[model samples]
Target: MKKLALAAGVAVSLVLGVQPGSALAAPTSVVLAASQASWDQKLAVAVKFGLGDDFALVELPDRDFVIGIWDHVKDDPEHVEVRVAAETAFAAAPEDTDQLSYEFIITEVYAAFDRDVERERQEAEAKRQSDLARSAAAASIDVVADAALLNGSDADFVRLIWERVADDAKWPKVKAAARAARDGADSDRTAFIAAGMAAAARQDIDDRIAADEAKTEAEKALERARASKKLAANRIGMPVTDELLNLPDRDFIIRVWNFTPDGSEVQAAAIAATRSLDPVVWKAYIDTGLHAAVERDIQIALERKYQADRALAQQIKATATKNKDLNLVYWTDKALAGTPTQLDDFLRAGQYDLDLSTSFGAGEVLPSWSNTVAWTGGIVNVKPICCTLTGPELGVRNEPGHTGSTSLMYSGLDNNTTKSYAYLKSMALSRITVKSSTRLSYWIYPQSNTVRPEVKPANSTCVAIDLLFSDGKNLRDSLLKDTKGNRAHPAFQCNKVTVGKWNEIVVPLGALAGKKVTTLVVGYDQPGNTGGYRGLIDDIKIAD
Candidate 1:
């Protein structure tokens, strides 16, 4: 009777929804079959249609609901009842409008149901794999820990085991086991490893401490040696100290030359002892040889203290010249640990064009000769192409080999006028210079002679040639040649006068030989002239 009632209802639905032979009503038939099919078959159909999770659940709530729906359509025996139930469920849904809506909903619901099942399966598999990984990690930790405990005394073994494990969290146990092994019996291998590790660490620390102590001792010895140096004032009235010998630290070496009063070796000894630490002190003994300034015997005892300063300088120069990087030398009292510098070969003065390719940015001014702080190592006799001026006129003054002070100004008319001078504001001579008989050379051509008229006082109109010392003092003075004594020269005369021609002037190196030459400043004295005196100056060269 129930089956009969269901058939009657299905028939009524067909009457309301499908025409006797309409193609549009075919979907309605499919929906009814889906709703009434067996749970398994309905699930299969749902997967094919890609129904959502909730829709699949909505279709098959329980086993019995499936059975009831199936029973209503079972009479057909062609499984038509399943399609009828699906069609009915779709008709009942909120979104259904056309009779075919039920068929579409049933198809979608079954698809989503299949996807949900597959997703669950994948999740379970992932969890299983994760558990397996954790188990493997835990097992590895056990193996590492056992290895550490068994051979804790051997630092290499322990270190090797940890390398295999490579787990930071497990380090504590390994460390503890190692410590225990170190404390164990001497015969224990684990303890031996621990001892080795400790010994290595101790050795490293000891080495550093020794190095620091040596440095400290060297510094102290240098201070004492410098204090005892003999200084003499040269003709330029600058104090020049005698040469200091440089030596490196070594176990045993013959550093001090000519120990005996007769320039013969007396006793050779290792350099490790404090008494023979520095060579500078011993050089003093050599200076006042066998017949010492104080006691002859004292000089003999101090022969080993002398170090060869000149030899050291030569060595330093050799090494520095080979260095590809920008090499700069600075004077220091510190004792060199290796070869010393030989400054003589590197101290020649010549016009130098500063090579500045290594710097990072542009617009960087190249250093000119005479700037003491220009290159490394205190200035010797070198000519700068132009001064990198300071103050407001820094970038403004572009002429090479120019030096000037704010106090002196140049008159554009004559080179001698100092009223408004054209100067390289920041340039200055180094503290060290060459002071001997020197012939100054430069080409000077005046564009005008407005300020210091052609005939000015001989002494007053003279161009001061100063061999500036490092301590801010000039050493020489020379006047422009008096071709016509007491008569001033015109601005346009080149060959005979100091104007309009590129005249080659020669200066003697002897002028800068005895005294240290830091800078060479060429300018006029007081009553200086101002602008409008134009001089085309070039090629200021210095040579022996």
Candidate 2:
């Protein structure tokens, strides 16, 4: 009869599509299955007959059925509360049919799930806060490290480190070590940052245990000795080694003495410190004396450079005067009269770009000889029948002048005048006087192409100058030679003239040194050419 009832309940559950708490119309069809029925058959009858709240207990004899339910709902998103509760109950008694019952699955599973969810939320929030705190701590550590490196004061740096990490629980060992160094002697603070803080930080990361604090006095003294040797070696670019670190105090000082340049301040200090044979002296020299000596050495080197620069400036000034480059002379004078920086500037580039001809001294300007009309003498002579001088007018041009607002230009056309000659002469200047030491200097710009001649004593420069005297004598017959050693009568010839650039002509009155000047003349004589011609002149001065 139990088997028949169980089969009939399963059949009714399948046909009616009923759930666990549905109402049934026929009481006979809804009869409860017997105790020996399988759990699925009992569940089917409970669903078909709506016996969820019945007083009689449904016998779930097989524990696998509840285990299957737990496995199915454990990962079901819609049954999170039931899944967690079921997990809890299964953990407590996985094989106990009483705890695995449907009644416990609906009630305790949801309550346990809620509690676990809240616990996970709190843990996630705590981890986020910890990450943020670590980030902030890292930034603060960077700032403090930068300040320490720049300040160069080990004691103050250690104190700052202590204050920064004092309340930070993550760096407990670092904080303690920094505090001890902060309140200790200056050497203690220096030693801490040099090595102690790094070791403490490593220990804190590995395990939060107190560091060893039982260093013997002798051991501390030995550490200080090694650190001092290393610091000195590093400062002087000497390699630090175990043998160097273990040297006797005097021998160590001797090593530093040898490492420095002979006769250097550091070497002298090292020798003095070594003579004392005292550890305190050695420490003091390493800590402060070496730095002071190095500074003194630098000042000495700078003083030597200053002296050398002054000597060089004097030499340059003399050379500038010899070259007759007044621009260079002016700049050198400024350098001599100003600071060392100005002297360096003059040597570097200031003297190279300025016009040397514009600044003249020991000279006299003749206002009557200022323009082209004073020198042209109203004469334009052109040779050869085919040659014609189209223009010989004098005008002022703004550029290509040696000095002043405008230069005197004399222009004319050749008109196919091959092997022709043209000349311009100055009117008589009987009012001007010449002395034995008199010298005439002027600059000229020739606007023509210069060609080398195939044959002939005369080159193709086509330019010359002559000085006339009161005795009707010219420069060619006189003993006067221009600064270039060429006779003043034929100044520009044989590559001596530069075309398209200003050229200076200086004539010293050698034979006619103390005579009155009659006239000044300029000429063009190209042996085998014909074209337009132009030239500029400026800054006519007489010097001695």
Candidate 3:
């Protein structure tokens, strides 16, 4: 009966819109053969009770209703008599037959509860499997993405930079960036690979380039060190150590020469080469040797000097002698001049003969003949070219003159100071130049009016050829003679002359009719005014 009722009960659960008390209508021809039946009989009975194969207690709570199954018998005509008898016995209440019917109902209800619980467990298991599979698949995708990027950078590109190294943990993060670069925006696949590699190796690449450059520079320094040692050895006939090579080329060579015992042509050549590097060192070395070679050089240099000044002192003297160009002989004796006083008094004689005819040069100026300053240590201590000793400065320019390539040029500028003088004073002659009746002749170009007579006079201011006479005496005697009444000299003042054109100014030495002159001075007297005090004086000479 329990089987029969459950079969019919499950079939009624499949019916759409069947309420708790609703009956499933079946055909009157269908019949149940027995009370307790097999599964096949129960199936057939359920079909005959008007139920489909699709029935489940889990989906419909009303499918477990006892009334639904009771309806199976209520609607069946073929089993109506037995169904009626069973119903009357179930309704009478306190008999074993009635309890049997209740037990059947309890079995059906418990069976439905069991089916619903089992169904819930199966559904939960399926969902669990689905969630696990989804997580595993996502992990696989992450691993694949990160591995691809790492492989792009030479297999070893990825590393655990932190102390805690779980490659699996970092995979997702690296994969995210690489995947964005790879599949998101970048169109080129190779770009992803290159970018990954560079990002990984940036620090390493910079360090390598720096190391290579440092190594190359070290190699070059070693090569230079070797070259310096070789140069000192081959050139100076001595070996230079690595320490000495640190010195510059000039200083290094000088150190080597200072130690060299004998200076031969090899040593000389080495020193000469260093002259471009250090002239003072070369001069110290080469100038120490005294031989025919050096004397000949001196004579050749003087031979090219102002033609007339070279006349008498052209040949070097073995001893102090007269009849030489007194000025030339004095300066030429620098090699053996002992002291300046001896050279000045080289001639133990009377006044200088005033051989102005021979004192003037012919044609062109010599490179050796420059009287740009006051004389000292031969002529090397000549004074400034031209000056006013105040506000204005004088410029000296050299061009073709009456005789030589050199001439005196006084640039014009105003001097606001009182008693300002612009003069070019010749160095003291070793001997005196006697001129009393002689005529002082020179070519002059006075471009401005500073030298005209209106400004030049005996007392106030003038532009003149100034002179100083030494009386051919010693320093004290010369100063004493200048202090006493016996001393006398004059300046040949400038007269009215053409502007911008060369004019000859011949001054008769009647003012100094008896004095012998030693120092010849030229340029402006103390004329106070705006001085573009410009002029050129050349071919200065004295003749009877």
The model with the greatest TM-score is: 2
lDDT of each: 0.31, 0.50, 0.36
Model 1 regions more than 4 Å off: 1-437, 448-466, 475-497, 509-513, 522-531
Where does model 3 exceed 4 Å of error? 1-326, 330-354, 357-396, 403-405, 433-436, 448-462, 471-495, 510-514
Residue 433's lDDT within candidate 2 is 45
TM-score of each: 0.23, 0.30, 0.27
Locate the minimum summed-lDDT window of 10 residues in model 2: 23-32
Cα-lDDT of candidate 1: 0.31
Error of 2 at 190 (Å): 26
Each candidate structure's count of clashing pairs? 94, 3, 12
Question: Would you list the rank order by TM-score, best first?
Answer: 2, 3, 1
* Residues 253-326, model 3: lDDT tens digits: 56755654454443454466576755554333332221222223324433432232222223323211222123
Model 1 Cα RMSD, 1 decimal: 42.4
What digit string (tens of lDDT, one per residue) describes model 1 on residues 128-182?
Answer: 4333322222222333124334423344454454464345442344444445544
Instruction: Give the candidate number with the greatest lDDT.
Output: 2
